[model samples]
Target: MKRNYMYIVLAYGLFLGWLLSFPYNGPVLKHLVLIHQVPIASFSLVYTVVPAVFLIIYLLFFQIKEEYAKNIMNWSITACIVGTVILFTLPTYYWYPVLAVMGIGSVMYIIGWSYYYTMEIPIDEKMRIMALVIIIGNSIYYVINILHDQISIGFLLAVIIVPLIGAFRATSNIAVNNKIAVELEHEPLPVKLIFVICSFLFAVNITDGLTFHAIYPSFDQLFVEYFTFYGIMPYIITLVIIFFFGTKLSIMFPVFLGTSVLGLAYLSFGLMGKNWYSYFITETFLQMGWALLDLVLWTLFGLIASIYGRPLKICGYAFLANLLAVFAGGLLAVRILNKLDNYFIISAAFAIGIIFISFLIVPWLSEAIEKDLRNKLFKTNLQNKPIEEISPLSIPLPQREILTPREREIAELLIQGFTNKQIADLLHISENTIKTHTRKIYSKLDVANKRELLQLSFSSRMSKGRSS
Candidate 1:
């Protein structure tokens, strides 16, 4: 069963990789532009915007019930297959509609599969699984690029179909329960944390848009001329890094490293000028940096979804932010940056500024996110404990008046299993302050340890229940 699950994940990862790499590097979009006379910008806009719209709809109104998961997945995949066929065979007039269908289908399929996977998989294993999926998915695209000059329609069909079959067989018998959803209703959404994350993503992607044209003359130029050395090799190095260190490091490390490398890439373009050697150097760093950021983006969303138990909504909002940022960035790059005399230098400076800001801000962001997760876990642990384990005190808890208001707040968290450091993080105070508060809380409650404090708390609650 576990092996089958792994296969399903890998299959989806490969498709995801193809989605990420092919439109930019492979012949699909280029063929549409060269043969079918579809404008590159039009196709890009439809594909990007349509998915964003779908996510908006999903977030605002649509809810996927557990009973319909399989059907939604099946229909989404079918739509994608049909859209692919339309892209190949339909008239140029049908291109926009085809792209829209593909976009909507892709969003539905990705979110459906991802939500189910996150819900079913254990937390400890998720990071490693995500890393493997990313590596395989990306590696497959690069491998195909190396091996085939023109990917046949039949091969593309197989790529989509084979994965669909494997995923269906693996997940067909499984039933998802609504228990997590019910639990999620009780936990408040961490609005501040979500805002921070989305804002960071928006900033990162916008800069990517601003610098995109400066780095590559066109998408085809990168893969067509330097497919082997500059194109594939840098990504290979990135894959190796992700495979080895991705799961081992703190999540924020990648965010910092990726932004820094991106800064360097932009800096290279600014200093060295646009030539083959410079493009090679810039592209290498860009690929490595972008790959890391992409990995972090997906992983972070997955973590948020798992923690909140609202996978579709969380993932939907994240994708929406990403799409909008890319669109906004691309627009600015074309309209504003390209008109400037020193485009590369200005873009590089913007990127460098973003890196420095991230260095200053990412530590706080990491702590805020960590504090939320700790708080959630503390609540979950308390809820999941057996009733008998929460032994009631022979006497009631100490009177609330015994402690100051601040110490009362600290006592509540302490009884709820928050560590001193976690309390400090949550309350935005120093660890030393938390320790001082803890000592006062212990004195006021007449408790020696956390276990006794918890007992008194439970007893107080039970006593109130009996009296009322």
Candidate 2:
């Protein structure tokens, strides 16, 4: 970890130098879009294809046979790079017919790949549903890009491409690579609690890129459109930094998660669905927050190394917390957006408040999510034999799955001694609003009153060995 930190500090210093070296009006290294004269095939060979080859080579050379996960990692990056290219290369000068296939193929591949992300959830029939959704969403954006690429390639990428790829990397990487700790130490919760921080970094980085486009639409439209591929660089840097430097979950996780929630809440609810432009603007804020959030994550690492600890997990929570948060947030954001004619007013007010509350309280439900995971298939035969009705790996989250992102937050708040009024205040809604959200929290926690809620919270974590 220390080594990784050194790389980041050096990289950061060099990056700062480059930023300062540029003529303000001429070209900022951070924002400079690299253009290559090579053909798509040739450039992809160097960028996408070769990197894939390298990973294959590395894995083979090292005799690493974890094909499912490693392949997903390598190819997912390729999909994003190629997809970003196809998404951006329109109407400028380098539009290609193959881009259509590349775009579509990459989408399918990523969707297919995400299945292998976690040993807990491998590819199955369900993945088809996920793939179809991707196709539908991409088709809509594809049409939008065709219509407006000339005006602003960046906007489409920011709103569409970035999120999709971000989601892609998230689901796949976390599922496969991250560690699933059987329990937490209670004191300085490590991997489990680290999730909040990862989400913060992820949300902020994504939001940071989006912010540029929101404020400066034209430039962002082109530069960011192309740069979305490179946007992965910070995360890449983050991983490298983590690998060499060492980070602590207790320190980094909380701060990153807090920043991410606030920023993402601003993106989704801040504008309150005022318009497509609102989304554009809010997303821009989220993108900037992501980088700063990452810095916090790195700092968390610094603190950890100051002592002596290692992140027990990697892509698992680092990726999933962000994924699930976005999943839940997007679900809420869309519902509110569609249901409320005053979309902006309703969406912004509700999302921000809940987001804040969630930041304050999700660790409480760490138990429930884990409890459900542990006993999911456990049962005792009449005679006296233990049997698991289902493998935690195979059984999908039920239609009535436990703890949603919102409910989890509500649980946290409940434990924190947040009354309905306080929650309402934090969420920018009414007391009645708090009642409604609290009700959901109760259902998820399977308890009545604040007492049961707190009881369930502790019990759930204790089951998972997370006691703090």
Among all candidates shown, the one with the greatest TM-score? 1
Report, for all candidates in order, the number of backbone clashes. Answer: 0, 35
Q: Write the per-residue lDDT of candidate 1 for residues 221-248, one digit (tens) a residue.
A: 5455675435646755775666676557
The TM-score values for the models, in the order shown, are: 0.78, 0.30
Worst 10 residues of 2 by lDDT: 21-30
Best-matching candidate per lDDT? 1
Q: How far is 165's C-alpha from truth in model 1 (Å)?
A: 5.5
Predictions: Cα RMSD each: 9.2, 20.1
Alpha-carbon lDDT, every model = 0.70, 0.39
- List where candidate 2 sits over 4 angstroms from the true fold: 1-191, 194-290, 294-313, 351-468
